[model samples]
Target: MFCGGYQVQGTIFLNPNCDPMMDAQLIGGALQGFGCDKDVLIDILTQRSSAQRIMIAEAYGSLYGRNLLEDLRENLDGHFKEVMVGLMYSPPAYDAHELWHAMKGAGTDENCLIDILASRTTSDIFQLKEVYLMQYGNNLDQDIYSETSGHFRDALINLAQGVREEGYADPGMAAQDAMVLWEACQRRTGEHKNMMQMMLCNKSHQQLWMVFQEFQNISGQDIATAIEECYDGYFQQLLLAIVSCVRDKPSYFAYRLYSAIHDFGFHNKTIIRTIVARSEIDLFTIRQRYKERYGKSLFHDLKNFASGHYEKALLAICASDGQDF
Candidate 1:
């Protein structure tokens, strides 16, 4: 159920009984009243798949002669608006916007950069780059290079190339790669960074899994532990993200969701981004993983952490899995 490291199981799917014009009519009514009917917005937008949402957007413009996203911006505000607008974009377009937001302005959001680049598949990255260029009028890789420096920048650029090996993994090569990684960790020299980066960034996820297993056998520690011991700063974080996604992408994202909710006063952007981005991909899997890893359903945690229309919209996208709110 996985394609190129992305799980095919998604909470949101194409609505079999879809009527774009009717849905657009309801959405237009929701936008027309004195106070926007956020309930209607949540119900209509959250229930439709991304492709369906696009159709609805087209229908809205045809019926109302107004852009859906711009209307949402004019009518809605705050994090709720962010979520609504985010749902309007295709996955790659959304990712491109997120990347541009992360890199632009006074400081870089290293975590955002790491989360997106490390998690996307090669095809996703390629589409994202193309969209970024068309939308932002700049190259994503060049922008990332300019925003970052040293080993971290090099690693990000390497990932941005979107040329990681795919489809086949050799046990023999995995063992060799593992040994090379172990030796790099032991050496802890400038050259060691290159060695680790090459192996981690270039190998397919399946091959990396084998390499990680071989690494555990060769050394008494996991690859993550080895990376932690040898490196520090954003460079270390990016490597760990790659390994984490390779091992179990859903689990990695589940942990990210947990941290976003608990690590601070509510890292709402990360919360919204993770849920909305994965909703149509593997959010159901992420939700299951969240409960398994954290001993509580994602819906339960979000209900506790958030309130009002924002919470309702997020829960709607999360969909139901027999979890009582």
Candidate 2:
């Protein structure tokens, strides 16, 4: 149900029986924002299933005078814009979010860069870079260069430029790498770094899990244990979350936030800041998972840790979304 975040109602799809091209014409007219039928727009677009949305988008392109994407841009803003963009643009939203995370911090979120750039399809990612350039008016590579330095930055930037294979990762090969990482960790050798940097950098959580299980069987050590022995601080936390995301992301993040607050004494500013930033993305799904695992609402947990306008802002974004503003 929850692909990444945001609650999706399955009925919001296009009518399977409807003529898709005609549907696009009607839908695009409603979404036009120039005295368009807001009621019709809301009824049709809001109820559209993901597949329907995709069809409508296609129809808008094929049958309409203008792009549906351009129309959405004219009307939607903030969080609503994000939701519309996610459904309209598809996988690029994931890359956009990844780029957002990579650029948001005081320093670059290189982990995000490595994970997203190396894992995504080259064509999709290349298009995403162009979108970033068009939207932000600065080259994505230039931004990456500004955020980091040296070989690590170059490696990340190179990946972002999409010179690598187009999602050409082999699951069988990944499984072998996972085993290498586990074995190298046991050997107390530098090779562990290479294996982990590769595995954690690319590879989906699902693929990683398969490889991880194989790695564990071959070497009696879980990915978490390997990370603990090999890395530290935020990188360590990121790796642990990546490994656990396959199983239970909500619990993993909840555990991390709790530990950071209770044991490490992270300031309220830091806690609220991180939670607020992620609320629009990971927090929605994380909340669902947190509720399932701990029988407590994420909103409630967040309230316990935060207060005042900051709390309201985070809660508001999570509940009603940012577009309501």
Candidate 3:
């Protein structure tokens, strides 16, 4: 989730000898109350990794002869319900579901699309594309093509191809790529969108980091700043996301989390999706980055911005100290 294991410090981890039936009972006992044991629910759900949660779900269903996810939805409410259910899905499956939600809505969520596509690694994208096809019986590429248009659509298609060049980077080539990027944005204007997109999307993170540095050396402006000055609209946002992910993904997601739920009329769905999706990944680093940047705890902010089970669920996931709940 944060630069292909470049940042391995995360909030969630495998609980040793995690027993699924024990988890089932813990959850079952929690739900066996008049008011739904919110604390117990948060404790159980937030502490387990995704694999453990899946096993717990299976155990719960087998024990009670009821679908665990359905029961979760029936028992929980609002943004909390979405978070719990989203946590139940496997990572690739959950990402595919998020992409489907983004494109299926009345107006496409271009931010969600760009966020998922631009931030993911080549291998992750490959797995997500496969999951999307198997789960929905539709090609991810075709769905993206139909849902979007113009240079942004073309850029997304390139990303969905899952064809990034990986492994060691050539420094000389990185410098050349940087020069080409500078020329495209500065001298030639928007005449080389495809070249820029290909370089941004296809190169390995190590390669792009070099290219971005050289780009700044040559142009006297960061790649993101140059892209902002030269490009506009969805394409510019996509390019910026790519640059941000390559540079510092945890910080990027921290900022994204802030935007999703910070303002008046917050998007709780985005909050649920992002926090749930990232909980088992680099959410720990993201939380630290958020606190450093915003001068307050992410948990405190979520508690203020949201209410009821939703706030509790998010705090459980955020888990200020990055320890198991």
Candidate 4:
């Protein structure tokens, strides 16, 4: 259920009575004149699904002869603007944009690269590659290569290939793979990177889960613990992310949400990106996992850390329907 690629466990869904033109008109009214109606923007955009939002964006462009993203860029500011603009794009385009922003500028956001490349499904990665190429006129793998180096770059490029095995997971092969991983963890040499990369990048998530279980039996250590002890820096984080996602993606994202809130004050960008990106994917499960893992609701934490329309928009996307808490 949590394997991604149309297995949606999200808080938002397609509105049954959605009207693109009407939504566009309402957005136009909110954005017109001196001060924007932040409440209207939040209400309409947060309620609609990503597909519906796309239709609304198309309708806005046709109705007003203006680009919705650009108009939003002009009208909104700060994190709220970022969230609204993020909502306007189709998911692939938004992901491409986020990846671009992460790699652009002086220092690379390795966390962003790991978060996306490690977690997205194969089909999602393929669409992201196309969108990245079309929107930025650059190959995503090439961009990643140019920005990163060593084993970290190697892991990212491999994931970017979007060729991970899918469908039935063979238990026997998983046991063999687990032995190979155990050997790699024991050696911790240059070839260790290659072995780990091959198993982590190529195996299906289900197979990887079995491998992790086998690995624990073989080494008396969780795969995550082995990763932490054997590797360091970005490569370590990326490997950990892949394993965590394979085990429980929603729980992985819940930890991310918790980190975004608590790590060195408020990581607004991470908060916005994670919530928006996962809003239509598995944020419902993430909310439940957050409470289970941290003994508090994600909404409660967000309410404590954020305020105003920005907070309202996030809460709307992460709302629990009165049951998750």
CA shift at 120, candidate 1, in angstroms? 0.7
What lDDT does model 4 reach?
A: 0.89
> What does the lDDT read for residue 128 in candidate 4?
93
| Tens-place lDDT digits, model 2, residues 5-94 | 324211122345656677677776666555545445444444444456677788777776677877877776543344444445444544
Candidate 1 lDDT over 1-325, as tens digits, reads 7854555567888888779999999999999969999999988888888999999999999999999999999999988999999999999999998999999989999989999999998999999999999999999989998999999998999999998886669988888899999999999888989889988888999899999999999998999999998999999999999999988888889999999999977899899899889988888888888899989888889989999999988888888332442
How well does candidate 3 score on lDDT at residue 78? 72
- For all candidates in order, the CA lDDT equals 0.90, 0.57, 0.84, 0.89
RMSD of each: 1.6, 8.4, 2.4, 1.8
> Model 3 segments beyond 4 Å from truth?
1-6, 29-35, 187-191, 320-325
Cα lDDT, model 2, residue 256: 51
Local error of candidate 2 at residue 81 (angstroms): 16
Error of 3 at 239 (Å): 0.5
TM-scores for candidates 1 onward, in order: 0.96, 0.52, 0.92, 0.96
Q: What's the true lDDT of residue 222 in model 4?
A: 93
TM-score of 3: 0.92
Whole-model alpha-carbon lDDT for candidate 3:
0.84
Task: Write model 4 residue lDDT over 116-197, tens digit each, in one string.
Answer: 9999989999999999999999999999999999999999999999999976589888789999999999898888888898
